[model samples]
Target: MRKALLALAITGVALLGTATPALAHNVLISSDPADSASLATGPAKVTLTFDQYVQDADVNQIAVTGPDGNQWAEGPVTVENNVISAPLRPLGPAGKYTVGYRILSADGHPVSGEIPFTLTKAGTGTPAKVDAAKASGAPAADASATSSPSGSTGIPIWVWIAGAVVLLAIGLTVALRTGREPSQEKTKQ
Candidate 1:
């Protein structure tokens, strides 16, 4: 009985101690203009939505490869909700464009992938130059949603409480099991 109780206690402590919350990567769920969609005109901005929020505190860098091999995305990436986007000046000669993005997920790990879309018609706007302000600055979007989904590190308060609880449970169990039968022993003597 004692051994079984000890094993259960140990198992409980192990389970509680090795608790790793479900920290997952941000999977791209959908995108505006849809991947490889043939659009008649260019969109005002390119947006990528993810299954989980991407960390936006740190700059998320995305590369836009145009049909002409030119870059169209301007400035730093902005994230709102689970969407990461950048401004697009205009569309070039109608063709396919690929946007590649590498962003820090809420888990603090970097997640990256490439998606492409085609333009059915030509747009007559130059790939606008990145403005110095927006270029140097990240979007004024949700700071937390853009970063790792997992809250930053260092022992959480719950961890300390868990440790205390486990120790207390172990101590109480030991005391109850080992420190009993005092009256029985005295009567036997």
Candidate 2:
């Protein structure tokens, strides 16, 4: 019985360790224009704030899509601590805009979401210039596109938890079975 209890305790500790990383994925705490906000004029930039640190990597991306489906975000996305920001070209339309972002969480997972905001009035800003290669119909290769489907770090959180559970269950079952043998021998004696 004591051996079984010890095995169970070890399993519990392993399970707890495996579960912590699952909770570490970054969540968007706030944004510059704010989600579903209606603005009188377009801002020159869009910023997103998260609940945890974000990995500052080239794989991070933010795309501001206009009502016309034009990509309005200019240059590369920048990350500083928990905040990520991207420059915006002058916005020209007077409708809804969607800010789509895929950021690398500090735990190495990719967190993606879209924030929608309405433009009450259009600004005189134009979309950023496209690269000559892209303008000429060549597809641009990017880190996000080339990345493995599992993510940057490859191993997912669920896999770790599942492995831990399986190992714990096997060990606990063996421990309980072996513990019963000693009690049975004592009774026979």
Candidate 3:
């Protein structure tokens, strides 16, 4: 019984150690415009780089709000490995413009933050027309309804947990059976 318990405990510790790295979340390492930068003209597109790969999901969003509180990001956000980018319309009205984003991380959780930059000079650009639903504060419709469902590239954490349970069960069973065999031999002798 003691041997079986010991085997189970060792297996549990090993599984816990192995899962530590998989649970880490991605961290933003840098951005194209740089946070709080003063720009003479706005960038054509904004790019965010992370320490780990960004999940490719339809839920990823980047909203560039100009100094006038109007949306400037155009088209859809794109993800390529650790980098995520979104196109922008020409920037208008100089002042502080904020680039806000929410993205699905590689580990399957949503991460969000904002970057602010100052537009030193005004440009000839207009804000994208905001959808009535978005302007009204309603949840935007799922943009990738027809596309394939999004998920992690790795084997899911649940699978790992299930596997650990199976391993522990097997180890305990073997340890218990082996421990009994020696006692039975002594009784026969």
- The candidate with the higher lDDT, 1 or 3, is 3
lDDT of 2: 0.77
Give the least accurate 10-residue stretch of model 3, judged by summed lDDT: 138-147
List TM-score per model, in order.
0.61, 0.76, 0.72
* Candidates, ranked, TM-score: 2, 3, 1
**Model 3 agreement with the true structure over 76-144: per-residue lDDT tens digits:** 789999999988889999999887776777877666777889999999998888783254221122222
TM-score of 2: 0.76
For candidate 2, the per-residue lDDT at 3 reads 84
State each candidate's clash count: 12, 1, 0
Give the per-residue lDDT digits (tens) of candidate 1, residues 96-174: 8877776767766666677788988888977644454346443222233344425444244576568767766775676
Backbone clash tally (model 2): 1
**Candidate 2 lDDT over residue span 1-189, tens digit each:** 788888787778878877788668899999988999999989889999999999988777777778876667876678999999987888988999888777888888877778889999988877655662233221122223533546566367568867887978887897778678666778998
Worst lDDT run of 10 residues, candidate 1, spans 136-145
C-alpha RMSD of candidate 1:
6.9
- How far is 130's C-alpha from truth in model 2 (Å)? 4.5
Residue runs of model 3 more than 4 Å from their true location after superposition: 1-6, 132-171, 178-181, 184-189
Residue 69 lDDT in candidate 1: 63
